[model samples]
Target: MQAKAYLQHPILGQRLRECTQIILNVDGRSAEEIFGYPDNLKFRSCLTLFMTATTDNKVFKDALLKYFDGKPDTVTFDILAHH
Candidate 1:
């Protein structure tokens, strides 16, 4: 959840767990945080989470596009800030 302000410590602390950022890596922390780890998640929860984190929808949209596009080498799931 790349956003402006700090709302969730669990995800924030994940930053500390990672030694470096890997482009589109979707590491453990990222996977768990974004996709709810091994647990099933609702689309609404994911949507709300993203919306809460992202203040600018346009930027978020762009980032997501590029992420899925797999073109940029700089976009990392570790800290893909969209604010």
Candidate 2:
């Protein structure tokens, strides 16, 4: 499969970075320490799945809209879904 391009919007990029950072910060270990060698790629793939699901799911969208005061357009959910 072809790789998806990195998001062009700064907001989306920041969100993805924050998510990845949160995963890395779990258990007080750096991502490298936690994931080690081959598992790192698998971890990242799972992260992508997470991001995609969060964007595509209606429940998540509803929560996001509520959190951001109904500004659904501000989220790049459609863009994330395609990725």
Candidate 3:
């Protein structure tokens, strides 16, 4: 079959278009409504399908030590005072 014939076939492109429209109409609006923020952020967040974190062995050890040390002190008097 021709490429255009396959694309135009009833079971393919038409159904895909319908599903895409439904998603764009419903989920797109809901996503915008839920996460839309008017205030300007200092930086724009860029998304990547593949991301990597790099650290030296010593740096990772130091960060791990700091994280464990800082955990217990995260809840301070100021936070308790709010309650």
Candidate 4:
């Protein structure tokens, strides 16, 4: 499913797009491949799992911090921090 279907805000949608790209290109991780049957995912669970590593809680934050070059703005980081 397209991100716009789940993400209502344009800026958030853009950020999600970028995050997905970073995970895929920079991190060499496929979001859809990791997330089986992507269309069937529960929005909240999908988002939470995407933002938090199943292996370790700190991994997600570390990944996000690195993705943003270590100085991510509060609003964007806040959303990632929650999960």
Candidate 5:
């Protein structure tokens, strides 16, 4: 409901998208501990949700693409490497 309401205002939605940031913190925990075991839905759901969001959400995709003023790859690499 809130997401739908936000979508109603394109400018506001875009601004929100621009302000979003994601930290893929793999270093903080083991991969299995983070996503859960494959026998359960937690692992699949988390992966699927992320895949769908990144692939289907145009605004989110663009924001990620332009992360840190179009330095997503470099910045993300640095972060993951450091952390």
Candidate 6:
């Protein structure tokens, strides 16, 4: 299922909303501002895990590089920090 759909699943939706609220309370920014949106955060986190799990895969590396538009390291670091 797509990240948005998965996030909308009742249990997962509640968990994500709770987490997002906590994050906003501490950071004072909406999840959209910090992570694009809940779905974007889910997608980025999944992609990060995929990249890490397949570190030797050239295709994953290439895709991640393209995802970050040539700033993969910096963007990945920021994403990691945010999560």
Q: Give the per-residue lDDT digits (tens) of candidate 4, residues 2-62.
A: 3334454668645665655555354543333555464313322434444433332343445
lDDT of 1 by residue, 35-80 (tens): 4634212322332344345553333334334333422223232334
TM-scores of all models? Answer: 0.22, 0.33, 0.26, 0.28, 0.26, 0.32
Candidate 4 contains a number of clashing pairs equal to 0
lDDT of 2: 0.45
Candidate 4 TM-score, true structure as reference: 0.28
RMSD of 6: 12.0
Relative to the true structure, candidate 3 has a C-alpha RMSD (angstroms) of 20.4
lDDT of each: 0.36, 0.45, 0.30, 0.44, 0.40, 0.48
- What lDDT score goes with residue 76 in model 5? 34
Error of 3 at 16 (Å): 0.7
Candidates ranked by lDDT: 6, 2, 4, 5, 1, 3
Q: Worst lDDT window (10 residues) for model 4?
A: 38-47
**lDDT accuracy of residue 56 in candidate 3:** 18
Best-fitting candidate, scored by TM-score: 2
Q: Write the per-residue lDDT of candidate 2 for residues 1-83, one digit (tens) a residue.
A: 12223433467755755665555346545444666875654554444434454443443233333333334432344555665
Give a tens-digit lDDT track for model 3, residues 1-83.
Answer: 23245345779645534543443344323322533553111001100000011221233223223323312222332343465
Candidate 4 lDDT:
0.44
Q: What is the lDDT of residue 11 in candidate 2?
A: 75
Q: Give the C-alpha miss distance for residue 44 in model 1, angstroms.
A: 7.1
Q: Identify the candidate with maximal lDDT.
A: 6
Total backbone collisions for each predicted model: 0, 0, 0, 0, 0, 0
Error of 5 at 41 (Å): 20
Between candidates 5 and 6, the lDDT winner: 6
